[model samples]
Target: MAKITYIQTDGTSTIVDVKDGDSVMRGAKLNGVPGIVAECGGGASCGTCHVYVDKDNTRPLSTMHAVEDELLYCTASPRLDNSRLSCQIPVSDDVDGLVVHVPEKQI
Candidate 1:
């Protein structure tokens, strides 16, 4: 299981254990992390499950899919090099201890 952390705009934080094959968005929403809206339910349609991955961890994740790239570019928040739509991030045993920091908002 991957250990993911979400930091809300209010400064509160939630930590969840994600099983392999589970998307980060699913893990967060299932665990009740506050800031991830996940409006499109992992379809890459809505940009609501946006998140800024911790810079250090960005290198290991798979390359961004085309749809993910577009959604990230159109998010309400400014895109960072580490920015990603959480729904597109699949958890894995390799990412077991992975940690993600949520941004201030998702709109």
Candidate 2:
């Protein structure tokens, strides 16, 4: 399992262990991490699953499909450069220490 950390806008942090092949949204839902709505359930149709990933600048995120990028524009909150849909991010051993910042609002 990968240890994923979710940081809220208020600075509250939640850490959950998610098995490989599952999405970060799934981890939040399963572990009750707040601030992730996941309205589309990983479909990348709705943008409520948005999160700001804190990763090394030199390492680019993997598997960010065009649909995720398109849906990000529909988020209730303004998108940031590190913005990403949690559903689009799969949990894996490589991302064991993945840190994501949850926005203040998700609709």
Tens digit per residue, CA lDDT, model 1, 19-100: 8899999999999888789998999899889998876674367669899998888888788888889898898876666667
* TM-score, cand. 2 vs. native: 0.92
The lDDT for every candidate, in the order shown, is 0.82, 0.87
lDDT of 1 at 24: 90
Query: TM-scores of the models, in the given order?
Result: 0.89, 0.92
Residue 75 displacement in candidate 2 (angstroms): 0.5
Worst 10 residues of 1 by lDDT: 54-63
Which residue pairs show backbone clashes in model 1?
A: none
**What is the overall TM-score of model 1 with all chains considered together?**
0.89
Clashes of each: 0, 0
